[model samples]
Every structure is written in structure tokens, then in C-alpha cells.
Target: MAEYAEITYTVEDRIATITLNRPQARNGYTVRMSDELADAFGRADSDEEVRVVVFTGAGDHFCVGADLSQGGFDFDGEPDGPWQEPAGRCAKRIFLMNKPVIAALRGAAVGAGITITLSADYRLAATDARFGFVFTRRGIFPEGASAWFLPRLVGMGTALDWMISGRLFGAEEARAAGLVQRVYEPDELLGKAYELAREIAASTAPVSVAVTRQLLYRMSGLDSPLPVHELDSKLIAGLPAHADSVEGVVSFFEKRPPKFTLEVGKALPAYLPWLDS
Candidate 1:
């Protein structure tokens, strides 16, 4: 079993709980964590018994974005290059998944953390939860599609406020700003998110839910951007199969870490519309 450095996933009662497993660093993501999450989500998506997903941090914080310990990616080295695979898989895969995802946010949800929360179908934050877009402060442009997704969720003005300022907001402020769906006491957050997830799982029809998700994402793309889902998924599926996807599935059933193959992205079909019948 390949041990994951920063994520843990378990399935029960048709729901998967994906925990950001790095409390020592406030659940900060590394390239490793990003890959691990994408692989975990792939397993949950393929499992017929797993209909709902609840994302939460292992300890106090949900996530504080990328690991400062590891520093940031060298995006300048290549255009449309090496970094794109892991980066896209982490954020884009979560955003594009057909299954319902509910974020149970506690402590800090900064940078990519906040972006992922925005991508979720529902977000339940602790009263003390902290949210920020720390990219600008860190001297980099937002890479996690916040430039595209945030405005759609909260409109242009508010998106400008967050993205440009990189301001951190408390949970109440986050809820008021429309960053979170609801706020609960810190202790109540997990239960409330789980409750909401169960409600959604019980109420939504499977195939219909998937189709609706597809439509929502498709419609959210900008006029200038490519039809993102078709292109993104084509790229993901074309990758040399990560050992993690198989290990992740087997591990969920047996409770183990995934041994993964090295990353590789191969050619795939063009990004195009689903043909109307």
C-alpha cells in the first residue's frame, strides 16, 4: 500500500469522506496532495455505491492552500507544460466531477482551498472558518480557475474585491459575501455538512444529478474559453493510468495508501460538444 502524505478517504453508507490529512501544516496541499485528491475523487466517482462526497480537514483547518514548505510551482519554465497536469487535475477535476461534493470547512480555507470550496455544490463553514485568496499576496496570478469561477459565483465586483486584495474573511463575513452556503458553530460544521450531503444524496436521482452537473459547468465557462470539460476530461483520461486510481479504489475497500505510477499525459480526442441526438 502506498501511503498518502496528506489525504485520507473512506466510503460508508454510499458517501465518501475525503479528509485533508495534514494538520501539522493546517492541511496545506503539496503537488502530492493534489495528485492524491484527484485519484481519490476518481475512485469515488467510479464507485456505484458512493453517491455523495464530503470534504473536510483531518484536524483543525480545512486547507491553507499549497504547502509553503514545498514552495510554489515553476510555471515560468514551460507554457502549456509539465505543471499543468497536476494543477488541472486537482482543481479542475473537483470542479468537473458529476457527483455531489459538500465542503465541511473549519479553520482556514485560503487560496486553492477557498477555490475548491467555491467549486463544491454546498459549503458549510465553521463560525470561525477563515477564507482568503492568497495568490495576489504571494506575488502570483491565480492559477486554480478563480479568475474564471469566482465571478460566476459571486459576481464581478465581489470577485474583484477578493482576488485583488487577497483579503482574509471570517466565516460570518464569508457567508454574508456569499462565499459559504451556511455557517455553523465550529463543532457543528461536520455534522451539518454531513446532514446536507445525506439530504442531497437521498433526494437527487443519480443519472439526472450527473447530467445537471455537466450542464452547470458547461454553462459557466466564459465566451472566450474553450469548452473546458470536454478538453479537461479528455486530457485526464488520456493520462497513463496513475497507480493511485487503482490503489485508491482498493485502499478504500481495504484501508491502505495507493502506490502510483509516475505522471504521464497522452494524446486524446479533441475538446468538443456532446452531439445532440
Candidate 2:
């Protein structure tokens, strides 16, 4: 029931679509848009009927980065203020969501635009999509925790190269460097994203996907597999009693689609340490 002025949020067929609405401005990034995006992400994450989130823009462009209409940034906030950088809030919200997020990008996805989508589970871009870590060029630091997420996705060397150079790259380069998972024509981009989202919604157990996502992001960078092994043991031990486990097994044996009834908000195991954090 939330109302958004800078973005449109709608849920249908288990997918929540969040579109940046400032098309005339080429979906320019703004503080209002950032907060609205965070709110929409939280709403979809909490909605049991929304198993996936599609992040996209309404017009030809996804986002052309900050609205620079006022000439430049105004940095007059009190040092002791509780204010958070708006873009970081959006990134953090998306990072913590239990439901999967797929960002569909076309045209210009530069500066904050590109950085924000780096946290999504999947980035599907149109062939015309152009991306840049343009903060250095703009005389500002990168937002959306790009330093951390970029290196993990594209490697430290490529991250350093693109970030330091502040150069724009096309979708093919983005895919080759691992920044995006797929590329398609602009017209076909959203269709493919929805197709992949549908596949996930139909085949995967919601609670299981949530746990596995957290495990991969939270545990994969460890120096050794010992901790992961221990956590995996704990997770595997409880699977027999899990409702989704039963449904998955029965559906597989019967050669039918799984009717996994476990809701992500409720069915995540209590032993997950990060849930409390």
C-alpha cells in the first residue's frame, strides 16, 4: 500500500517490479528515489506473495546517475547527524533481502546507477547498456559499497581499472568481466529477466533459496571451507524436518512441479546467526 512518487512498485505472478519513474530526467538519481527504492525493496522482501524482485527503469535509460541539475552536490550536513548516504541505504536493503533481486539495465547505467545494481543477484543488461564507475571522474567517491562488491564480482584488477579510470564500458565488456550475467536487445531485456525470474519462482523453494543466498554471500569468502562445512552440516541435519524438504522430495518423485509452501519471512532456520545480526 506504500505510495511512491519517484518509482512505481507492483506485484504480479509472484514478482515485484520496481521501476525508476523519472524517465524525463533519464531516471536521474536523487535522494528521494534512493529512499523510495529502499522502501520498495523492503516491501517486496516482506511480501510472501513476492518471491522475486525485478529492478528496472521505465524509459530507454535505467539511470543516468545523479541529477546534476543544481550544478553539483551540496555537502552541508552536520557531521554528528544521523543521516545515511541515500544510495548506500538502497544497496544495503537490497543486499539483506531474502527474495532474489534481478536488475534489468539499458541505456546509461553510470556512476551511482551502476554501483547500486552491483548488489543484485542477477544483472541482465541490454546490448546498448553503458556502465561506468564514474565517481572519480565526478570528483566524488563511489557509493553503494562498490569497492567491496565490485572486486568480488569482477576481480580487483578490473575493479581498480574501471573505478580509477572512470571509463564507460558496453554490455559485452560488462558480461565478459562478470559485472553482468546476460545481455540482450533492449526490447527483449525485461522479457528475459522475467523469464529467468519465473524459472526461479517455479523451481526453487523460497526458504531454501534465502538460506543459500545468505550462505554464499556470507560464507564464500572465507579462507577455509571448515566453517562452511560446519554450517552446512547444521543446515543439512535439519532438512529432514523442513517442510520444503518434504515437498521437494515428493514433487521430484512424482515428476511434478514443487509446491513449496514455506514463506521466507517465517521459515528461515532459527540457527542462522546472521538473521539475528
In candidate 1, what are the lDDT values of residues 103-136, reduced to their tens digit? 8998888887777656778888898898898778
Which residue pairs in candidate 1 collide? none
lDDT of each: 0.73, 0.91
Top model number, TM-score: 2
Question: lDDT score of model 1?
Answer: 0.73
Supply the TM-score for candidate 1: 0.75
TM-scores, one per candidate: 0.75, 0.96
lDDT of 2 by residue, 84-192 (tens): 7767878889889899999999999998888888889999999999999998887889888889899999999999999999999999999999999999999999999
Candidate 2 Cα misplacement greater than 4 A, ranges: 74-81
* Superposition error at 16 for model 2 (Å): 0.1
- Residue 273, candidate 1: Cα error in Å is 4.0
Ten residues in sequence with the least summed lDDT for candidate 2: 73-82
lDDT at 59, model 2: 93
